[model samples]
Target: MAQNHEIANEVLEAVGGRDNIASFAHCATRLRIMVNDKEKIDQNRVENIDKVKGAFFNSGQYQIIFGTGTVNQIYEEMEKMGLDGSSKEEVKSQAKQQGSGFQRAIRTFGDVFVPIIPVLVATGLFMGMRGLLTQPEILALFGMTKETISPNFLLYTQVLTDTAFAFLPALVAWSAFRVFGGSPVLGIILGLMLVNPALPNAYSVADGSAQALRFFDFIPVVGYQGSVIPAFVVGLLGAKLERFLRKRIPEALDLILTPFLTLLIMITLGLFAIGPIFHSLEEVVLNATTAVLNLPYGIAGIVIGGLHQIVVVTGVHHIFNLLEIQLLERTGANPFNAIITCAMAAQAAACLAVGLKTKDKKLKALALPSSFSAFLGITEPAIFGVNLRYMKPFVMGLIGGAAGGFLASLFHLAGTGMAITVLPGTLLYLNSQLPMYILCNGVAIAVGFVLTWVFGFSDKMLNEMKISGK
Candidate 1:
């Protein structure tokens, strides 16, 4: 308790005292503060504070990393010292003000998609499990071939793995509406209308199992199962229209009229205009992405893997979320997930090497756990707190990432999922993919560890950072 209080006091003094803070908040692993003047805070002094692993200025706020549990304790102590606490949204609003217009648009897309990733991730795992269980070899051991498997059992598997993607647009739309400050229920219904059974399924139409309903022998209409872009566009436009209608309609009429007009206008535009136009554009983007990922001799893998962590440093990596989602929707697989996993694994290995090479006990303590956290797909601690603080290690990690990514592409490794990476990502490769995934990550770790140990770290480097060896 006393240690927390003392640390909080030191932080207060280091950040130019109470008068300098505009607002403050803590997330899962960092204390976020927006200051009246950026020049007032001592970055080095804040990093030097006990239990503070790292500090960086990002967006419009200064974020001090304190790992997971420790951050909450420090935040409680700071609150007791009379610093008013703000919600994360307030901090994000402050951050939103700092970036370029393009960056803000990317951030909004992130806001819409992040809430939907877990559902897709779970569906991917279920698909992987179904694949594993249905493998001929596995089924033979159970005295069953594909033909002998119970019809009900296969249907049950489909229920688990298929339902999420089947209704994915609804999830995307609901999230978009929430982020756009509109009624989520309305967004859900609007989305459901896109995939209603009355329309021909998009996949069926594409595969020639069913024909699309044509309007004026030109406009094609199909149920948007497994679609993303059209639903997102409709949700955004619908939310804006709903808000606009609410302001103009009388209060008594608003209750009845707002939703009626918003749905009618959006659905008509969605099916006839937005759906077809954006869906075609979506196809173009997906095709381009597929071509890049399929670039000869693993070039795409090397570039994306090597530079991905660099992008993370800029705090704009969430843009990949949309691309990954689109890949999953179109192809039923995500190659990007496998490639990024290599990048993450390399980062973990580089941080671990630094932890092992450093004689400073405090630095070692921070590095080891941070490395493990990276191994589990959370790399910010390892990246900002350990690897990037020493430039050579970060470069070594990037090289390692490139090497692993090359193997991932050469092996044609694609996962059944998105989001989950590194250790937890194994669930997405539970079939024939398991061996290649393991090999790729192993190469990344070895390359990262060897490079970092040989050239990236030394006690002198620590000395320059003023980190003392005990």
Candidate 2:
């Protein structure tokens, strides 16, 4: 660790001291740096530094890829040197050069989603466990009677489980604000407005009679209680708007007026414009998804299962959360939920395969825990630490994910609620689509396990490819 730290500091100095850095951030495995002049930085020198795995520039940011644990320490050192930005110029420039249409769309989605993954996984697992404990049958199986599951315990568990989803906008707001160099508090306040219980609700009339006027009109400012997209959009707008206001507002009144006016305008626009547009788009996507799933279960499962890892990696997996919640509210079961479950099973299979096949003792140890975690619906450890490091495991995971997805779709298995654990969550699909869900899940896990065993451990496999040539 000391050697790693010294290497990181040397690399930072090589790139150009604190003043040369425009902004700095890190993902799971890379230290992302924005420099005032990329040409002035010595990329080769930085890359050659000890413990520096690799370095590259993309999306207008200089990125130094390092071990996951090392990246954060490096970023902290950068912050201490005052490299963090106070302006939006770097982000704006990156956004503009990101290209147009689908390319830009995917990048934007990834930018918004990746930062909040840790929180999502933690909360998701808590919810999944809560579901297991709450089930009377499951409790009895554990030798704990219904009396053991107290109301207070259930209530607290529900709160812990649902906190992430319920305050999703706030999370989005905080993340976006950080990215944009704005006050997260302001963004959180704006996000809360869209979901606030004190705010007015929308109503409908069935018989062509006049509907009573609710507090706010039904102009598509739907509740953003558990939303992801709206807060992100609003945060982007707020950041740019706040910066603009700071320069324009007079120095005397800038402190109070800047935030006040910024919040008002951002919230208004979020509700009236951005919120409605995305809401409609979401509805369309949901409807299209339902239609696709309703057609043929096997095909749907295959596509969803295969794309599950990709979706999660890109961070758009939350779109499924919205679809699931919407379906549950309307129909009590969600078709998309099964896709995620299968995705987890596939990841686990891939991890297990890599664990069994690896010659390196350390790699195998890493893979073993990752496999167990992925089976429990936590894929980050497997994705970043194990599968991602081995080419074969990643491909196998994708193939396995697709296989599982297809099976789930074919069986038409749907989940009653979101889950963090795949094994226990399968029970949630038992009531309406029990047979199909079981069959699909079983087939997916079996295929994943078999394929991983067959391909992952083979001597000729890509996982055997080693950087060190050991």
Candidate 3:
């Protein structure tokens, strides 16, 4: 408790005291601080503070890695010391002000998608569970086969596994509306219109089972069951239109007119204009992603797996959410999940190696738990706190990531989902893919451990840290 206060005081002193702090907030693992002047803070002094893992300037804020529970403790101490911290969202808003337009755009995409990840993850787990239950071998062990399974049980499984993607556009639209400062309920209605049963089913039209409704035999229209980009576009345009209408419409009539007009106009454009154009664009993006992922001999894997963490450092990795969701929508699986899992596992293993090899008790305490967090698919602590803190371990982790990714590609290992990886990722591979998924992560962890053990850590690094008080 006293250490938390001391750390807080040290941080305040390092950053040129309370008056220099413009605003501050803490996420799960870091203290994100905005300063009145970047030059006023001593970056080296802040990083060298005891229990502070690392520090970096990113996304318009000076972020100090404090690792999980300790960050909250330190944040509380800071709060007690007359530092009036902003809410994380408020801090994020200020940080967004500092970012370039492209960074802010990417961050918006992140905000829109993050709220929907848990639902998709649950649906993926359900899919994996269904696959396991229906497998002939697993069914045989239970004295049953696909033929012997009850129709009701099969229907139940479908309900669990198929619902999310079936109405994914609705989810996307709802989230986008919320993020874009519009009514989410209207977003839901608008999204439902896109997938309304009155339209020819999208999959059926694609498979030649049904023909799309056409006007003048030219503009064909179909339901957007699993589409992403169209729903997002509609949500954005709809929110903007709604806001525009709200300002112009009389207050007495606003309640009735705004939603009515907004929905009527957006739904028309959504079906006849935005839906067709963006859905085509979405297909192009999906095809391009597939082509890259299918690049001969794991080339895609090696490149993406090696450099993905580097992208994370820049805070733009959330853009992958779009590509990943598209892949799942089209293919019913996400190969990208396996490759990224290797990267995360390598990070964990490298951090673990550093922990095991280091004699410094403080370093060991930070590294080991950070490594465990990475194993569960959250890698920030392992990356910024431990691995990147020692440059060699990060490099070793990247190499290990590439190696494991190569195997993932060679074995054609993929997951039933995204957003979950490494140990929890095992749930996504619960069917026939379990062994290969395990193997990929095993190779990543092993290579990371071995390489870091042999070359990434040494007594000299510790000596340097001690000498520099870093």
* Residue 345, model 3: Cα distance from true site in angstroms: 0.6
TM-score of each: 0.96, 0.64, 0.95
* lDDT tens readout by residue for model 1, 154-248: 99998998888889888888888888879999999989999999999988999999999999999999999988889999999988888999889
Q: Which is superior by lDDT, 2 or 3?
A: 3
Q: After superposition, how far is residue 321 of candidate 2 from its true place, in Å?
A: 6.7
Q: What do the candidate models score in CA lDDT, each in turn?
A: 0.89, 0.66, 0.89
**Candidate 2 segments whose C-alpha is farther than 4 A from its true place:** 1-107, 110-130, 133-175, 196-198, 202-232, 270-277, 293-295, 310-337, 358-396, 410-442, 455-457, 461-470
Clashing pairs in 2: 297-409, 297-410, 298-410, 301-405, 301-406, 302-406, 305-401, 305-402, 305-405, 306-402
What is the TM-score ranking, best to worst? 1, 3, 2
Whole-model lDDT for model 2 versus the true structure? 0.66
Model 3 regions lying over 4 Å from their true place = 465-470
Better of 1 and 2 by TM-score: 1
Better of 1 and 3 by TM-score: 1
Q: Per-residue lDDT for 186-276 in model 3, tens only? A: 9999989999989999999999999999876787789999999999999999998999999999999999999999999999999999988
Residues 263-333 of candidate 2: C-alpha lDDT, one tens digit per residue = 99998898788877775675686678678778674787777778777766553464454455445434445
Q: In model 1, what is the error at residue 230, expressed in angstroms? A: 1.3
